[model samples]
Target: MRTEKEYVQWLMSVPRVGYLRCRKLLEQFGSAEAVWEAPAQELLQVPSVTRNVAEEILVSRQSYSFQEQADFLKRTGIRVLHKKDPEYPLFLLQIHDPPHILYVKGEFTLLDDKAIGVVGTRTPTNYGVLVTKNLCTELASAGVTIVSGLARGIDAIAHEAALQAGGTTIAVLAGGVENIYPPQNSSLARRICKQGLLISEFPPLASAHPGMFPVRNRIISGLSRAILVVEAARKSGSLITADQALEQCRDVFAVPGPITSPLSQGTNDLIREGAKIITGVADIWEEYPDWQANYSHKMKDEAFQLNPEERQLLETIGYGGVHLDHLIRVSQLSQGEVYRLLLEMELKGLVKQLPGQMYMRSSV
Candidate 1:
């Protein structure tokens, strides 16, 4: 006998059946198994269930193999999460049309709740790349899980930076988690699975189509507390994510760029339209003071002891690399005082000095 979830999976596999349709059927029948067993007339009674869709559901059920689906998931180590499942993302659930089923290929944890979505043009300029790397690296180091669509340019850079920072990230795919689109990103997808997650609403083998991308953008914003656009054209898909973020009541952030660049048009417009302007991770943290508190609590939980001045300096440094000049200016400490604190923190393995007089929090 198939489980109720297996029946839901079967319903999902039927042609013309989508998240909303599946939801309607399940709500009317009370269970996916009931929907599976529903007759043509009964299925048709559900709102938006046409005769053709009803027929498809019935016919597909006869041919669908629950055993095969189960075996495939088990073999590939994919996990399924329904909206009702407690393990499903809490933030995602707050959105209006959350995915009915999430196909996960990696670890998902509560830490992901502190996520920020980073997206931009598929073909980014050098300046865009620099901004993405610096911001994402810092955000991840600060324990903010970076979320993106796993596209070619900025998305890939964001994921790579997060991993390099030894932080978590999530890639929301337009296609199946197993069927990585833009095949070049296959290796990056694998890396993300080890450190974060690769998730989709589609099944493991579902191929991507053009229409799937906009649909996928909602999940990106839905999972994040805020969405950041590093670079985008006047008409770019990254803008769609930002729009969805606003609709979902999630914060929208944009990195300002040169006015002359077409790629910056979207982001600059966002800044003009009331989206937060982010120059660095400090700008992001200013929006979420609770995150700072959480970081401090986390440090205390790990038993890392520090005096008031040391704590203040560490907070100023944040998780990302900060220039010594910026540190001294922000902390309002004298040059000698900042240097002494940095040296002490470095020796204690709480911070590391990078070249160019930059400092960042150490993993310890």
Candidate 2:
């Protein structure tokens, strides 16, 4: 195999071959060495490749220069990861499309941590600020490394919360590892590199651009086990990450807010569509059960499990509440069977009987 540095340079040499296109190139070409030796006509024939790409390949092959870029990266302390590198993120590869290369500055192995993406509006409401901080802090304290865009507002809050909890935070940039957008967040960027990871698909000299953000959003969700939307507007880019997470089969959680707040629209819609309604870190508990051993809040409590009858009873209630008669109707069980299960659930502290005998989840 060509070393990762050679692979990275070979990819960067291809014109218009950003992370996605380069990923496709590797999938088809097998290795950077083989790709480098391929005919320019064959390079031009690559799906979605342009004629300029073929020309760039022909030229970079004749004049390959690696020392300057390496020295520049070395000066900045940014490490480049090629698609074949073991340090390349494993979860990202599970996505339908993933970056072929990444420029990471900081502890590279933070990518190995069990991670969750926390995203929301760059311009957030007060409620967004509150819950973003709360969820990130709680999740980080529970041992999850928080991941998010390093934009303003909610993203910044998520990273700050992770740091506050002494947990790792990964900032996925739309620009390069050396480029900090929003200009004002340079300090926040520094802190993230010091305590966690700052990653970008773009190379070191790449600059910030609005068009790059949607692609960045994909990487944010791609590297995560689940994505938590703390606050988002109807058209928030955070919603894009939520959609990508769903496509990747990662669980998505959204924090709700006041109906009047614009930031709540996207989250409320996610809830209506059956995304997990996360009120606290415990909502994510079942997904990370082993992590509970480290938290005092969790270690202090005993967990409840369901017996066959209880499972049947819970399913009878379905996604919403159900009356005793309806539970009997859906379960096709006799009134005696329904009553016995409901009473058992109440005794086990799993359900509560309403005024008219409807049953729903217990607040406990």
Candidate 3:
């Protein structure tokens, strides 16, 4: 067997055979080598095969030797992963646009782990840097792998924090496996290769370009269970990733900030639309009870599960601890119903009633 990786390299050499086209052909033909060996007339029989694409596959098959391609890959450090490989990301395979092959560099195990994407503006404010570090550190300690683009600001801070906390992270780049954009993160990229994973969908030696980023966002969300936007302007590229994550049916979380901060606009808007409002580590920890199983004593040490009506009352408090009157207005469950739910949830460790009867999400 020419192994799927070798076959994918052959398929990639064929001009105009993009991710989707390659996937479709493989599903129809059964294998990349099968498609390559199929006569041009036979190849065109598969759906969506362009007249030019079919011809290019024929020409390239005869001229491009597998050994030459292997040599090229070695020189550029691009290791290809085919769908059949055990190393392929399990979550990515579930997505509609799964890459036929991922051109990866650095450690591959990070792809197989449970990861959460931490994204935000490229030029982060001081607050963005602090939040990015704190949350990633918390998440990492709780046994979640961090995922992010290797761009500047918040992304860099998130990656660094994961490493600093003695945890692994993954950087899904918009360029080739050998390329790191924003240029300045070269040292950080090197550290990630040593401790985490750095990957891309493009071939080795391919330069990073503007349009490739939107395509790159899918991989970020595709690799994560949820995405946490640390800070974004109204028009940040992080918003693009958030939208893609929603379409991919992943949870979206945003930290609330002061209204006076311009960088808070996107996050505040996300909260208004009912995205999960995140304040501290517990808000995220409770959302994934599976983590509780392995969570250090600090996380599982004090936790409780709430019933439906009680859970509704707890949500009324929101992330930042809403006051009693405001929480009642927002919940709309009436005082009697609210009081009962609150009492049950508070005893269950889901919420705490402050001095003024305001409720807050419990940390313990």
- Candidate closest to the true structure, highest lDDT: 1
Candidate 2 per-residue C-alpha lDDT over 1-364 given as tens digits, one digit per residue, 9 for 90 to 100: 4475665666764557776667666777877666777897777767877788777777777776567677788899998886668888888888877776788999899887889999988888765776677667766776789999999999999999888877899999988878788678889889998899999988766777888899999889888989999888897888988998999999999877779888799999999998998766656765677765666524212222456666777867754678888777777888987776675455333566667887886543
**Structural similarity to truth (TM-score) of each candidate:** 0.78, 0.76, 0.74
Better of 1 and 3 by lDDT: 1
Instruction: In angstroms, give how far residue 213 of model 3 lies from its true place.
Output: 1.6
TM-score of decoy 1: 0.78
> What TM-score would you give candidate 2 relative to the actual structure?
0.76
lDDT of each: 0.84, 0.78, 0.79
Model 3: per-residue Cα lDDT over 269-330, one tens digit each: 99998879876666777788887565553542233334565556666676577777776677
Cα-based RMSD of candidate 2: 10.5
Query: Best candidate per TM-score, number?
Result: 1
- How many residue pairs clash in model 3? 0
Clash count per candidate = 0, 0, 0
Q: Which ten residues in a row have the lowest lDDT in candidate 3?
A: 297-306
lDDT of 3 at 141: 67
Ranking by TM-score: 1, 2, 3
